[model samples]
Target chain A: DAGVTQSPTHLIKTRGQQVTLRCSPKSGHDTVSWYQQALGQGPQFIFQYYEEEERQRGNFPDRFSGHQFPNYSSELNVNALLLGDSALYLCASSSPFESGYTFGSGTRLTVV
Target chain B: GESVGLHLPTLSVQEGDNSIINCAYSNSASDYFIWYKQESGKGPQFIIDIRSNMDKRQGQRVTVLLNKTVKHLSLQIAATQPGDSAVYFCAENPSYAGGTSYGKLTFGQGTILTVHP
Candidate 1:
């Protein structure tokens, strides 16, 4: 089975511009979560989408939002991007009953 | 103020040698723990995981030990290979309730493991 897949492996955006990253979760997985990994740092949780609604969120700002579709795909949108927003955006998928998660290769977002 | 952090920022070892990476978490209520290995330009891959009830868990060539009293965790790799070189991260589920509820993850800063051939 194909693992988690993310589109636009790499992206470059201007400061203040908005960007949207897409993710396709692994088959048989329903929950999708987004994480932001800064340089030399581990990923920080952004928010998680389940049942097409946001269930839990991290300490991120309002500019960060996400959506989950019926097909289990997900999209992460960051508005008013800052240079600090330049990082790897990773998407993880898992079943609610499972303790482990599968991750995508991630989208390398660069804000200039 | 809950957070997960690593004790070392980097580790170096020769190929075929065993390697160990350590982490500490501030959340005492965490019930589930996971170790992830991340390669450059990639996302975190699940290495292994253990619950609060279990003190240790082992996989193909990796082992995870959890100390609830000290709130510390460790990952050990046996006969490490060059391909095992990557950034290792430890994450915890602070609100793990079991069943069909998915818990959020709190990740450590991560330790860079270098396996020299």
Candidate 2:
């Protein structure tokens, strides 16, 4: 009965470096969506993946991309990161039959 | 652009007092709305939700009221406690609803709620 699990609870990276965050969806869930929350701001949708393919995306740039594995796990990869990329990255999972989506504690990315 | 926003940036209240958080949404077509509470250094936690078809829905100590005509939403907390101090965000799902269509969410700027004892 574990909820969503995200790896690398915290990360520090340099500008222009790349980072990949991992997420394991809750049991009995199939859809995974990634979001970015800046300081003192609500989360902004980055993208969503279903059936191993990206079903929808937000207004983020090409540098932001994601992948959904057959096991329903997900990975969010950010390339050419900038200091503005420093924020909390959250992963949420949901099922079609369920109305509520469970979110992980999130990875706090600090770009130095 | 579709967006959701709260009326206030911050609110302070005495513990055991009722608290109401208001939000205004730009998308009239949005059918699903949700409220999330996030503690420091943690992800947003789901509090409650209400669909357009319903005017209000109540959870244990929370109540979400939807005003479709005005494109507004509100979350009411009964007898707030210190543990309720956190940032609250109201999110709208503009995509198709029901089944698996629940996709990426558009969130507001969030409101900081401080409950004092």
Model 2 RMSD vs true structure? 0.9
Model 2 per-residue lDDT tens digits across residues A7-112: 9999999999999999999999999999999998889999999999999999999999999999999999999999999999999999998886789999999999
Clashing pairs in 1: none
lDDT of 1 by residue, A6-110 (tens): 999999999999999999998988999999989998888898888999999999999998899999999999999999999999999988666688899999999
True contacts kept of each: 0.68, 0.75
In candidate 1, position B49 carries an lDDT of 90
- Report chain B TM per candidate: 0.96, 0.97
**Candidate 2 interface RMSD (Å):** 1.1
For model 1, the stretches where C-alpha displacement exceeds 4 angstroms are: none
Candidate 2 residue-wise lDDT, B21-110, digit = tens: 999999998978889999998888999988889999999999999999899999999999999999999999977577664677889999
